[model samples]
Target: MKIAFYGSSLLSSYWNGAATYYRGILRELAGRGHDIVFYEPDAFDRQQHRDIDPPEWARVVVYDATPEALLRVMDEAADADVVVKASGVGVFDDELIEGVMQRAKPHALRIFWDVDAAATLDEMRSAPAHPIRRALPDLDMVLTYGGGQPVVDAYRGFGARECIPIYNALDPTTHHPVEPDPRFACDLAFLGNRLPDREARVEEFFLKAAALSPEKSFLIGGNGWDSKAMPANVRHRGHVYTAEHNAFNCSPLAVLNVARDSMAHIGFSPATRVFEAAGAAACLITDAWEGIELFLKPDEEVLVARDGQDVAAHLAALTPGRARSIGQAALARVRAEHSYALRGEQVDQILRDRSASITHRQQQMERA
Candidate 1:
């Protein structure tokens, strides 16, 4: 398929999980001979601080953030078999959404790819400022990175003709288990960028856990987290690189996951970290989430933490043998079902089905 994607930074993929998600799935699609042109609007300073260039596997096209430039690419995107208006890209200006879809509607199958589906849905539900609430009718399909069945059903309820969840997939080559780096070795580690709204959750869940376990060393790795006061037991390592992610995961006695507020509200949404931790064969201690059992077996392959106390308890009680058991079990489950190749294939299947349906309906209309 010749597909065009308007997504978040394809250049600086360091801590932006969306970039990592795109790199994993798109690389698999390209491997299968799909022609992919990913359009990135120059709205952020990622280019000035570029990390990884788009691989030869996919073509990268950067558009100026001007309305004219966006419309021009939308017209170009119209020629594609599938054109996707992905969430993020840091530019969800109402005019851009309207312009791109209006141009692409007649010539191509347009999709709204919500990488952060939970957050997007929350925004759309808010009145007046919701960019996509009014635009949903124009899209041919909706794709989500996570939020399994509930998310798919909610998109359908919002009138999407087709809604599919393509969960954040494991890129085995980059994320598989590696020998622990001595410097990153810690009893518990959490990796996520700090944002204002999520600060309270971090303090309650992450920082409190450190305070509770003064005997164990903890590490916090992400950007925008320097200002937050941390307990003495927790070491702050700002902005972990994607290349070093496997080491970060593998080196930890147990990796902790904290969800965004929206995801927490709409259960079944696991962050890309869960898959990465599992793929790296690291034991995971995550805050309680709904529908978690559907992916990783809680108490067997995964441990649920309700509060800082829970996180501390798990850490204190963990034996190397127990942690190893949890890691191995989770890795086995993820490898069997959640690789990027598998996710890419699932998405391709959905696109094929949608195309077939369109062709069939046209044939029926012509015959009638």
Candidate 2:
């Protein structure tokens, strides 16, 4: 199958958190012998701050953020077996959605891939007549990065033909354990870009935890967090590169996963950091969210924290050997069931099954 994906920068994780997920799944698909073309906007300063170059597995099309360039990409995208318009493209998303819906080939399976499903559905609920709402039923499938069953049901309620979540998973090739680097060494570490929805949670789960455990060292890594006031025990490393993520995870005694407001509310939504931390065999402590047991077993594979106090308590109680045990359990779990190869295969199976069902129904009608 030839697949065309339009999303955030594939070669840069600068302000594009979805880069790892996109690359992991698409690269695996390419390995399965599917031809893949990734179309990303040339905006967002991603090109300027790119941490990676185009990989050999897929063809990358970097188009100007102009109407003419988009139209050209849309026309080309329609030629593939599947055309995906991912959410948070960071430029002209509304236009891109409309263009894909209007120009895609009749046989192409059109997908609205929502990386931020909770946020998208929240906006839709407040505005029932949003353009994407109107477009959902016409799409072949609605896929999400997170928000498991609730997101699927919400999209189905909106008249979508089908909806499924392609949850974030570890790419062992990219996120396996590495030797700890002194530069990022700390008692606890949290890595996430500062967005409005996540700021309050970061304070609640990260900074407050740092304050409570004043003697313990903490590290914060991501963009847009430099200006925030922090406790003296916490060090902020603005915009840590993707290449350093493994070391960042390993350097910490335990890594933290703080959910954004919408993700926490939606449950089942795990951040990319969770898998990366687990892959690096970092003892993972996460703020409580519903359906979390589906990913990692609480108190066994990962630790669940209710607040800063809870995080502090967990950190205080954890012995070095116990932390290593928990980290190992998480690593084993992700390695067994949550690799990108497995996710890529699941996607391929979904497409194949959906296609077969349609054909079977057509044949039955013809026979009748």
Candidate that scores best on lDDT: 2
Per-residue alpha-carbon lDDT of candidate 2 for residues 179-287, written as tens digits (9 for 90 to 100) = 9999999999999999999999999999999999998999999999989999999999999999999999998899999999999998999889899999999999999
Provide the TM-score for each candidate, comma-separated.
0.94, 0.96
Model 1 residue-pair collision total: 0
lDDT for each candidate structure: 0.83, 0.91
Q: Please give, for residues 37-77, the per-residue lDDT of candidate 1 as tens digits.
A: 98887765667656676689989998888878877777776
TM-score of 1: 0.94
Per-prediction CA RMSD (Å): 1.9, 1.6
lDDT of 2 at 166: 95
